[model samples]
Target chain A: MIHAIRARIKQGHRTTRYPDEPMTLPERFRGYPRLDAGACQDGCTKCAEACPFGAISCKPSLSLDMGKCLFCTNCIEACPKGAITFTNDGRLAANTRDGLVVGPDTERVLARALDNKMLSLFGRSMKFREVSAGGCNACEADTNVLSTIGWDLGRFGISFVASPRHADGLWVTGPVSGNMLEALRLTYEAIPAPKLVVACGACAINGGPYIGSPDVCDGVDWTLPVDLYIPGCPPHPLTILDGLLRLLGRIPEK
Target chain B: MTSTMRTFRNGSALPLGDVPVLETESFLKAILDATVHGWRVSSYFGLPRGGGLRIYCLMSSDSRGSLGMAAADVAGNAFPSIAEFCPQIQMFEREVAEQFGVVFEDSPWPKPVRFERRLTDRTAAGCRTGRPSDVGVMEYYQVKGHEVHEVAVGPVHAGIIEPGHFRFQCYGEQVLHLEISLGYQHRGVERLVLGGPHPASLHQMETVAGDTTIGHGLAYAMVIEALSGTMAPARAHALRGVALELERLANHTGDLGAIAGDVGYLPTASFCGRIRGDFLNMTAELCGSRFGRGMVVPGGVGFDCGPELAETLLKKSAAARTDLANAVELLWETPSVMARLENTGPLTAEAARELGLVGPAARACGVNMDVRRDHTFGIYSMAQIPVATASTGDVHARTLVRWLEAEKSLYFIDEQLRHLPGGACMGKSNGLAGEHIAVALTEGWRGEVCHVAVTDDAGRFARYKVVDPSFHNWPGLAMALRGQQISDFPLCNKSFNLSYCGFDL
Candidate 1:
């Protein structure tokens, strides 16, 4: 196996130079949703309608409640003028639950300060217990790939624990389903007292495409409490890595 | 393609007699008889759908094909239990009885399937009022043993594996019975796909089982295309074949590494892991995603491999071939690895066929039922690769077969790339019409993924049932692990790598 070790070393760090160099995310990588108000039509509410969770408010002005946005591209895909696009920049964090509302910026400085503090609060070297309520398995695939020999997430000191009891954070994917509600709750409850729940995908935070499923609950937040919401249909590995480091207080709060 | 499917439309029923279709009890028996000659009744289920009860029976005859059903027009009170015919059908029958509230006449054990204890008493009933709770039907057969110790392992495990509960009844590591409790990670993926959006909306269906994504997606898309009577372009088909072969290579490499790890061969584990990583990177380079995601679409592929990626792939394919060659040599040459692997988990060819095993597991036990060769699709028939099999039916034989298959996959990938035709990838279609069609057969990596899609008049989905390969292979894994020691369970399980979510859905 000396040859294998030498080969790995010669491969010379397969990981991306993220947080230093700009992340080279894959094409079609789902991240945070940004709405172009210029292209936004008056009272055209396809994006709001397409949202599995009622994350967008189509009242006087197009308002997006970041707390409830599932980050699924049904809205972006539904947008007539390609007004809505999923931005790869995933630097969203907040102190209070209400601090995560992303609409017309009001009290911007205060919200930014709170988000920075929350990002700094959690430290580096993270541990996670990933919970899937009702996803298509895209997020889970990327998550598994993160720890493989190529990604080697263990080098970053980020490991996926089997038990929630031993975890400091919960990485939840998929839309919450009616069947897995009990299991999800028990898993979250099983996590220790001082734990955080990071809603990984659009499905978890909002409902993604399966919002009104009869067999499944629309959103995970509809059942249990959520701390950090990482938006994406299935967020890129770098987006997840960035969000994870932000949670662990590694990156300087932006 | 050398097609194994020999369809008989107007052939006579095998059971020699037809009970009235409305006679639910006799009808069930008649269907079972048609499936097997002796017709040893295995299991039965009472499923409730469309405002009525549907009775289902699972049966086995000899060491070939067993039969199961979704019986129509059966009232809850009149269905007869087949527990006496074959004792193995007990679990399935109990599952049906609990979930759909089907009352079986003269069942050996009559208990609520989902609920553990009967809450006939007022106190238990009082606690359940006015509260919305998530509770599943819990019904299990109570088989008492003489000092049978129960060990409950987890929905959450120590390793970074998916959640599953393994309840083992043993006398100090010599296992008597193994009861698996799953549905912990039941994501309701099928349910989401059925009602939510268009079939094209869910690209993640391929990755649902992770390893079996290419196989499952190809099956699903083929069925969808078949129903629509549309075939993808030649180049798209070739790309799909390449993706499927790469998937097989990656999974086989990982499985070998895991098997070595289980048997305490750390060097082999590290070597396999490193090579497996390279294999995955090669996949990423080819498809732009590591797990081969988004490469497969309903009509055809989402992306095409350009000349640059093709050249890179060809080079990497050769390197992986060489790496696996060296690794296989090391595994076979090492004395300790061989000692642990040889004769560790042996399932006879008879037992394997009886259990209806599929994929590499069945091939290792001498069942030459490969989907690519027997029931050809995509570029498999044109490429003409041999269906690799082993007669030993041991862990060593399985390892050899897998290694050989990886070599074959490399060869197949190389061939597909060399003959890469230029054309449009996708085909245009207005989707499937409103007709029920049963798309059944085996995929390369997993055994069989059967998809039944029925659309309404307006092209709205009415009923879609996806039976994953894991559903058929889980029982096979259980059978393989029956007589083996507790330590051998991981090796046996890793040999199959059955998907919990795929089966649960």
Candidate 2:
């Protein structure tokens, strides 16, 4: 008991005050991206060719699909003119799939509030059933990290419930492998109507690494409509939180 | 080890022709002989050919400090099952049978392992085989009696975990038998990497078990490097070592906390949970991904660390170390935790060995089989992390082994960071040597991550087999459940915490 108390004292109050306060991410942490399509000298498709998943294309106009991006520096490394770079800002979520697409025109497409009914229903307290369709456990791990002492996502009145029947919506990740599609559908069906579907990670938004494989159906969006798309290989906890908070109209729209 | 087999060290490439294609009897004999001679079966899988399949078995010996390889080209679909004599190869043979449609005659568990065959292949093989349409749909072994009941749980579990089904044969509160059905997470990784070293190969490796990014990633990278006839620079080795150990620290801390959580202990669980994130953030500090994705690249690492970052890691790791010690010690100090932990799910050393368990579970049973020390790869070749072991194979033993390994890993990380080698972290890659087989083994946080890459004539991958530690340890988990209280399932399961996706892959 004494040891527990002492340990608790030493590990005192480690939760972050983000959204209200400025989030301090690592220097090397690749989050939101910056693209300078105009900087290309001639027909430079280096970034597009360099990308493993074809997330980048520079034919008529250079554009990046944030949903398909793995956040790897392959594109940035391949670009000789230094036209592409990833910013430390991790707010790369959007309400629509097109919103996740970035070109010279699209500076940033952030997630917006769900309709007033959603705000009235789930703005205060929301329970979700997280389904790892074909997830690589990273998304699942980071999602679980939210419930830990530091993040304590439950403090925001957002919690992952045991059953989909009790959940307000579905939180999906991975490329949605064929074997898991039935289970995911059954889970999504179990939740009450007017439910939210938030797809986290590149896999959940677009088939991240396992794209084009016959084993997986593209993503959760292939079968079910995704209300919010948080794009990262596995989105950082802050990114996930920001997406959640933004959906609830909690954060002041920038 | 044998006249028919060819031996090579880990991370070393051998010409594929050097491995003698023995007759079926000799192949089985060589494998059984190698096992009797104290070599562990690292990887055994059948590669598909025209009509039949070629069976290859790779074994590693800690005492002899070598890896041996031998193959047999089966003319037709059938191969005589040695899984009857060697229970260790049961899962591998089952996997072979499922993937290539080869029938392993006279096996104990003749069921499909991970349901690797596609519907088209299943139909093409023979529709009359009557295979299940989907993964996890198989005939489960039933224990029938007057008061017997079966409890079937999940492909969709309660927790935020990958999917797998578990059927428990129960007599009231006591579980008589437990069978785990998986393959929900199979994305055809081995099949996907069949052609050239596709751009998605490294990405696939990183997520083979995302928590084990450093482990599997390192193994895959090492295989690529060996094929290219190059070694990652010393500095890269140092950084990879640090990343690998950090991964160990993060996962072991999480497992320790989870074990504590299972016993209803809150303080340690809560503290270690945050500390676990701290380690992950440190990994994020390395290559931006908390899970170490895109960190381990072929020929070297993707990122480099300067002195400033090394010092930062040193300080951060020290802080995590202190917090981890404080938090974990509470579990030891707490009598309730200890009472709940000790002798709850016991596996004898013999059972662990027979079942071919690896990683912490095998170590807890006093199997001194850490690939880092035994089959020394890049950084482990230079410096050694002592194999942590415990004699009593129980939840308490597993927990103790994990905690001990965590401390060692912390020390290792500190040592590697402080002495960060000078020079380039990345290296120039030469073209891959054709018709070569390289067996790369890494000591992942879970266990030995063995990746065997065989290059075709045009310097492309003929076959790539990844044997994640979960493949070896899942059966041990089943054995651990025998005759234990059904309520203790969570505690016992947490103790092993094997990767479902890694196993399925």
Candidate 3:
């Protein structure tokens, strides 16, 4: 007990003051992409050509899909005019799938808050049933990290429930694998009506790197209605929280 | 029938013709002969070759520090089964049968490995009809008698873990037999990787098993580099070493914490999870992603650890080491934690060897075969990290082994950062040689991650096979459940936290 007490003292208070204050991510941590069409020169398709997942389109004007991007920095690395640049800002979640597609003038694609009725249902407290359809476990892990002392997501009345029956919504990760597709449907059906769904990664949003794999669906939206789309290879824990908070109307709209 | 098998070093490529193409009789005999002399099957898969199927077998000889490779052309289903004789090859053979739609005459369990659509044309594009049938519906081994009940758990579990079905035949509280059926996470990596894995290959590889981003990423990178005759710069290798160790630190720390939490020890669980995140942040400091996703590229690392970054990492590593020791040592000091962990979910050393377990689990059972130490690759060849092992094959031994390895990983990171080579970290990988086969193995935190790539005439990936550590260790988990109380299943499962997607891939 002495040892335990000493350890707790050393651990201290780790929960970060995120959403209130901006989460401090590393410099190298590429998040929301800032695209400047003015910066782009004519006939420049380096960014598009460099993109592996076709996350970028450089036809008439350059548009980037946050849902489809892995943030590998190939577009930025290959862009000669510096038209596309990734910022340290980690908040890159959106409410609508179309909102994830950012044009040159776009800034942060933050998730829009839910309507008053929906907010009344889940704004104060929301329990999510995490479903890993075909997730690589990275998204599942980052979601778990939120429950730890560092993130303390439960402070905001947010948590992952053990059963779909008890959950307010489903927090889905991974491009839905075929075998899991059936199970995911069953789990979703088990949840009550008017349930929300948050696709928590690029895989869940647009299949990330596995967009065309026959064994997996394109994304979570293929099978279920996603209320919020958090995008990344595995979105940073802070990014995930931002999406959830914004969706619940907990984080006030700018 | 050729008796000679082409022996190659880890992450090295060999000409397709250089590998001994033996008759089925000779191939079986060769695999059997080598296993008798302590050789283990590292990778074995069937490939569609010229109107017939060819089975390629790779055997790892730890003592010799080389992998023996051989191939046999089976005309039809005429290939005899060797899994009944060698239990180690059981999973690989079963996988081969599942993938190619061939029958293994005497396979102990010829069940679906990942439930991915077989390569056969009939089931190819299983999702073409826009309906995927439910997996894990196969018949499970039963213990038929009164007082013997069956408990089926998950493709969707109570926790946030990935999907995998576990069937436990329990007599009262004690588990009689545990059979695991997986493949809910299968995203069909092997099928997708065929043809040309152009620009998306690296990202796809990184997600092969997402938590093991560094492990699978590095293995895929090595395979590409080997096939293309590319050598990463000295600095890149050292940086990769740093990233790999950080991944190990993060996972091992998290697993230790999870183990403690399962046993109702909150102090260690609460602190270690945070400490694990710290290690992940360190990796993010090196690269952009916490999982070290973009850090490793084919030719070299996409990101480099400069002097300033290295210094910061070193400081963080030292801090996390101290923090980890403080949190974890309580588990050792407390009687309850120790009692619960020791002898609970015990797997005998013999069982571990027979099942061919790898990584910390194998080390816990005193089977010392780490890819880093045994079949050294990357910067491991330069600075050897000593293999951590324990004699007891229980939850306690597994936990302690992780602790020891976590210490070693921190030390290794410290050493690498202090003396990181100052040079270019990125290079160009040459075009892959057209008719070549490459094999790469990396000891991920979980265990050995094996990637075998065979190129077509145009130097594109024709057959890409991945054997995640979970493939070798999942059976070990089932074996560990035997005679254990059903309540302790969570603790035992946590002890060997195998990757679902990696195995499903």
Candidate 4:
């Protein structure tokens, strides 16, 4: 056991120095959805059809509501432009509600607007209790890995609690199910006031392939109001790590 | 014994019995009688376009492997019920009744068995009334006792796991009866296999259950190959075996880590998790998928096992084996883990047999059944593997079995790679005509994965039935949970690692 611990320590710091330097993501990590207008046809509506969360729309032109987006990458995957690159640049936040927008090519426009919003501010910490509505456990695996000895996310005062009652934030993943709808409501109600709900992964933000299932609900927002949405099929561990830090106000809004 | 393939060239056979083609009532009785005689019903075939509802029952000991065939014309009978003899058939029968309205006489439980009853009503807007009926409302057993409070846990849980609901009838933590409700992760994969794409689109068949991708993919490819009389090249076959063994090793290592973690053995969990990560990284190096994706394509592999990837895999496997051995040894020194897992969730030999449990779950209980060893497929026949088994059916035994098997898989992969012949990796996969029905059974990490597929005149998928290992082992879970404390549930549950999505679909 001592040898194993020594081996891990000898491997050096495997954790990313996120606050000090830019974090490098894996090659194929699902970060956020990007819109490619050039590759999309004038009324193809493929993106909208592909979205289980109704995250994409083409009525007035392409529009995306990141708040509602599940980050499933299905829209980007279906986009013929070779247009979408899985980039890990989600640092968008706002004090006012109107900052959220929707429309075709909005991701490109928001990309520039959010660039200045990455303000690096540190503040109070909060506890998160994760729930897998109907996830494949990929996101859950990544969630647990973030808190290992290396990342030491607890140092940021960002911790995953065992129960929702003591939690300041409810971290939800997977597509909500018909049977779980009641349990979800009870959990949200059990938590104290000033509580927040963050929908993680494509399944939680949107149903993904399980959208039309008779057993599952649409998404977290469809059941309860969501405070933040981190989209990805199974978002990269670093993406989730960053998202949680941002929620705690420790991450700066650049 | 050599088995000859039954050529269903004209039309696939249905359950055979006395029935007026138009009368749904007598037809239902005929099918029920067949099922009661120990006949394993394979697939339920419904042709809304052809005004047909059929159940194909294949008798295992029958001559020429003939499938007793029977059909009920739903156009003549509005409702059909066959829930009495084969209660399990309610799902399929109700599906047919909701969609096609073939009424069966004297069904013990008669209600819409698949869809929402009110919505599936014949006059509902845009609802397809030509298919079977909807799902019936779930019935709860009545108990006369002290209040009998019910506590429901999940669709979502506090831990890192899939969605499933455990409704416990308890009196202050001491549970009375535990009822499990699942299906939260249903993705309609079987329906996706039909109409919208060609049979070649079966490439995604592996991804249905991400962790068991290689196993399912191999089974799907084998079914296609069997139907079309195609054989993958020797090199591809070797590569497939290599992928399968790697998959088994990765899963077993990770599961062993989790099992240790559940008992609060952090040293083993941390070390094994890291080792398992190395295994996954090796997989990513070999195939684009970190979880063995795109390794098994129909007819053969899409990519060859190049020297560089094979060499990298070999090095990684060696390192993983060394790390795991040392970690497990350290874990053995810790008495706390042993105290928690040693004799928990014991499944005796008799109970194991009665439940028909397969793979590691059965092996851990001394049943000694493994599809790879019993009825070999791919290169396993040539690999000449001895079945892994343990007499004690506890969590500890399962963990030991996994550890032992991980080493075996690593050995198998090394042997396969060394003797891998130099040759082509693919073959022709075209011309799937006649009533081509084929089945492929493989030993996935979980257990036996059986896939049966039938092609129509136009070569479209007439019916496809996928049976994951979880289907048979789920009953085993209910048995294992018996007389055990609620806290031990996680340890017992992790021992099986049953895939929720695999069974949901």
Of the candidates shown, which would achieve the greatest DockQ relative to the real structure? 3
Output per-candidate TM-scores for chain A, rounded to 2 decimals: 0.75, 0.98, 0.97, 0.75
In candidate 2, stretches whose alpha carbon ends up further than 4 angstroms from where it belongs are B118-133
Report the lDDT tens digits of candidate 1 across residue range B290-399.
66766777678877887877887899888778766766676787788889888877888776655556678888999776667655677765877787899978888788
Fnat per model, in the order given? 0.16, 0.66, 0.84, 0.23
User: Could you tell which candidate, 1 or 2, scores higher by DockQ?
Assistant: 2
Q: Which of 2 and 4 is ahead in DockQ?
A: 2
| Lowest lDDT 10-residue stretch of candidate 4 chain B | B1-10
- lDDT by residue for model 2 over A80-173, one digit each (tens)? 9899989999887899998988887775667899889879999999999989888989999999999998898888899998899999999998
Tell me which residue pairs clash in candidate 2: none
How much lDDT does each candidate structure score?
0.61, 0.88, 0.88, 0.62
- DockQ comparisons of all candidates to the true complex: 0.24, 0.57, 0.74, 0.21
Instruction: Give a tens-digit lDDT track for model 3, residues B1-505.
Output: 1247888899999888888888888889998888878788888998788878999999898878889899999877756888888888888887887788778886777777766667654344545256656587777899999999999888889989999899999999999999999888888788777886678888888888888999999999999899888989999999999999999999999999999999999999999989999999998998889999889998899888778988898899889999999999999999999999999888887888777888999999998889998899999999999899999899999999999999998889899999998889987778889889999999999998999999988999889989999999999999999999999999999999998888888
Model 2 captures what fraction of native contacts?
0.66
Measured as a fraction from 0 to 1, the native contacts recovered by model 4 come to 0.23
Per-residue C-alpha lDDT of model 3 across residues A102-168, encoded as one tens digit per residue: 8977655578889999889899999989999999999999999999999998899989999999999
Extract clashing residue pairs from model 3: none
Per-residue accuracy of model 2 over B185-219 as CA lDDT, tens digit each: 87778877887698889999999898999999999
Query: Comparing to the true complex, what docking class would candidate 3 get?
Result: medium
